[model samples]
Target: MLNAFHFQQPLWLTALVPLGLLAWWLKRHRHNDNAWQKIIDAPLQALLLTEASGKSQPALLWLLASGWLIATLALANPSWEYQPRPVFQTDTAQVIVLDLSRSMDITDLKPTRLARAKFKVEDILAQQKEGLMGLVVFAGDAFTVTPLTRDNDTLRALLDSLSTQIMPAQGSRADLGLLKAAELFKQAGLHQGQVLLIADGAERKTSVQAAKVLQKQGYTVSVLGVGTPIGGPIPNVRDAQNQPIVVPLQVSTLQQIAKAGGGIYRPLQSDDQDIQDLLTSGKTIQGKQARQSDDLQHQDWKSEGPILVLLLLPLAALAFRRGWLLTLGFVIIPLLQPDPLMASPLDKLWLRPDQQADQALREGNYEQAEQLAQDPLRKGSAAYKRGQFEQAVNEFSQLHNPDAHYNRGNALARLGQYEAAIKAYDEALKQQPDMSDALTNKAKVQALLDQQKQQKNQDNKNKDNNENKKQDGKNQENSSSSENQQKNDQQSGQKNTEPSKNADGQSGEAPQDKNSAADNHTSSSPKDQDSRQAEQKKPASDEKSNNGKEQKKDNQFANANQAMDKNKGQEQPDENEDAIKAPPQSSQPAPENTEPRGDPKRQQAIQEADTLNNEEKLAAEQWLNRIPDDPGGLMRRKFKYQYQQRRQPAGISNQTPW
Candidate 1:
């Protein structure tokens, strides 16, 4: 224990030793001076050399010097080895590299591959005897989560909090993990250390090369495969078939990496044989070394600084002059005085405003916390928690950091401003391109925008369909009205023609009577008979002309009916063609001797047809006006041209001379 003794402040002891010796010498010199002064002043010396004055005094000066030396020793802060219990010692240091890739989330083992690996790590830590252990967690990149430390509890706590989602990138980069572990061991001043890889063995080609380099550097790499050979599908992701995508353990890859590193590879098992093998392997390597140093043992030492301070109390009491007041003052002042080095316990327990504000935030008092927050980022975070997205956006805009921008994007997204949120995410990516959370959110927002666009297009399509249905209904109603009006006109024309046919029959009877009378009277005259024959032939020629005209009128009515039927399905009728086909009504009356024509009925039918055509044309114009202008202006112009053509034909007559 004495050999292990060391001083934390050796300079204090170095300077204090000489000062203590000088103090003792000065006390003796003062005594000698007093004696010489007594001999020089005989009269005064007689008084000074009285019994009280010459009485032998205690060694107060020596006591004071001794106290000074003791105080200096206390200041030196000495420490030494003091073993309270036996400790296991070893010569090796180990680094456990934990893989945090997404593949580790697969449940090939019980609970999950990562969970099992964590349990195994805890067991390994518990079994570790004297060696310093470090932790490294890696995914696409690697980082030293903890340096070489003898504190197992701290390592376990860090391990418990780790998951694949905590990693900023997602992929197996075993090479980087090994490199980080090597660096940690080097920092710990270990020329050779053991590396225990706990992973699913999803490694890249670079992993093998890195393992070889680590082997060259005297690191014994041992792999404990967390997953089984027959793997399971990873959760939260699926293939095109909507089934979970299976991920298998890369046994060959792990074996190759172990070979390259000149290490051992084994699957994790329920038995502790694999862990025992690792410990035995480390011990074997230690035994192969030329000699073991005391430093490798890593003994824990207790500081003797406080013990030295305790020793000063006795020395101080011996140095003090015998006085009740001085003793009381010395004891009371020190006990009453506060320690300047540290705060009081009560003060430490008290909460500060900032701390209270943080507590408020944790308790979900976001508005109150936002008011209390002094930092811009904290205020923004509080505002975000309160669901005040616009306020949060304003606060976060003042900050220029990746996390702030990423959070701002989330707030904007919540407010349904997807485009703005995407821009904010872009800014975050500019600061940290590998921010997976931001990338994932940006993709989600983009998908939402696409969905909104699709919904808008569907709504417009529905609206157009509704307008077309309405137009079809109106067109059907107009065609029915036109058919009814045409039927009424046909009936009226037949009624008017009946009277003309009866009158013609009456005129024929009269002509027959006249011919008979002529025949009887002219029976006696041959000249009279010849004249009557000529009159009969003239009547026959006139009747043939009348029949030809009536047939032409019938053919015209048939053509008009066919045209109406052809246009019945059309939404917009060709009014110009109807006007061109309608014949003009004759105003002049025919001579009585000639065939009497049905002019009045024909005029009435023509007037009614013309009025119906005008009404149809007006309806078409109204429909044209209701249509919206097309983007290209082509559809609007086409409607306008059709409307103009329809209106022009409404003025033309439906009737024409045969």
Candidate 2:
């Protein structure tokens, strides 16, 4: 500890020389002595000039010197012990993205490109000292083999298990691999990292873009080209004939990706040099940041100076006896206050309201711009951008220029006054004949007006059709009901006449009539066999007739829907729900018993058919459940979902599957 003791900030020790001089000056010409001389008269100076031969001594000056010496020593930042710290955050966080494409199955290296790539990664993990390392594999899509972790054994085990067959699809989608690396870094809470991509070749355009994205997020993308320049044919992959599909190393393309990602690119080597170079990619990647090796997260020195501030406690406590707390605060506070004369470039202190408004508009503060703008046109534009369309229209209405008229039209259109919008746009066209925007907008608004009118007409026609259909249905229903009622009355009169005659002829007729009434009542009850049979028959027949009518109604709706394309925008009436209602059930004509609306035999046959269908569906489901689950099913589904989500709008390459 004694040998290690040294000042972290030696420059602060220089302050001691100046501090000693200040203390000596105070001892010779103290303020209290100077003030006493100024207050005393010449005759009284003789009486007042009293000298103490070191009796009390100048304690204040001594105290000042001691405090200054201690503060200077503390400010020098004394340190004795060593602390562990990372040289660069680079080596500490890395994600290895390995390609599992079919081309990786090519025997370019000793065994296979993928196998050699795995060995190279093993070399990296073996060489790594202190860092979190992760594994990711990608073909058609990427998956996290393992998140950033320190368990090299687990990573190696997982790496050995990876193969081309395990991937859901086969393509050298290194873009997805790089993105997966980014995800791993983020998952592990690493703000920055290195992504080492091992692949024979990748989709060039997408891979470059992916590298750039990672670079922006402070992640470098280094590539280890896994195939030779003199390429080899992919094993088990051929064309129509026995022709092998050759996959080559995209060396130049990979270099471009490295450059874009602010990293280094190296081809697969026999030694660990490639891995070593990748581990130190951050040195070149972060340049100046890597150069200042001592700086950790914006701080160059972890000074123990503040801890030494505890030595000032005695001096601080003594200062309170002389009211020095308020005295020092008053002196320091004035110096700490901002300079009144100097102004920042953004200061709006001297700017006019309109000038400030212009500045606010330039800065994209539309609300502030609208509030401060003195000009009507400027205020209108600001209001328009803020979505205050009504206020924007009012503001623009005050101005008569072509831009103002055009802007007013836009606001009016937003307010759903298409006719008024067209008029405003016309005004703009009159002012500037070649105002293409205004002319186009005028035509659009006119078309809107025309469409609105046509829709209203269509809605009226549909309403009339619905009303006519309802009235006709009602007429048919009333007629059918009246006719049925007449037939029922006639039948009822015949039934009563027979019973009444029998009752009038015999003295025992009353008892016989009562017995017959009781039998009729029993037959009408729902629980009775006759009543249940009648009800069961009625529903099936009614349903058959309803289904036929429903089909006809659907046809009508379909025909109307074909031509009803216009939007029912704000111009349409809201009170049309009743007029546009579906046909009432009470208005439908009764089904005829003569027609085959339903047959009991037919109903029974349909129910039996439905039961058979349900049984077959259940049997099919059970058979499906009997099949064993795939071990790779989860990975396949995950890859499929990711592939769907991440399909680039700019199409993927078709040059080679690898």
Query: Best-fitting candidate, measured by TM-score?
Result: 2
Clashing residue pairs in candidate 2, if any?
none
Off by over 4 Å in 2: 1-91, 283-650, 653-655
TM-score of each: 0.34, 0.35
What are the clash counts of all predictions, listed in order?
A: 6, 0
How does residue 390 of candidate 2 score in lDDT? 96
- Clash number for candidate 1: 6
C-alpha lDDT of candidate 1 relative to the true structure: 0.68
Query: Ten residues in a row with the worst lDDT in model 2?
Result: 582-591
Q: State the lDDT of candidate 2 residue by residue for 1-658, as single tens digits.
A: 7887889889989998888688677667764554567888879976877656333346655666778888888889988776655545433678889988888887878799988998998898888755688988887668887888878788876665677766654556788889889988888776677889888888778899999999999999888889898889875444433345677888988898888888889999998888888877754554454345445543244567777789788888887676775788899999988877975966787898999898888999999998899899999989988899999999999999999999999999999999999999889978886676886777677777887875564344444444445555655565466556555655565575544444346556676556655554443335544644555455445444445455465556555533332333332232122113312210112222353548888888668757767767676554444344344445545655665465432244253444
What is the TM-score of candidate 1?
0.34
Model 1 over residues 394-414: C-alpha lDDT tens digits? 999999899999999999999
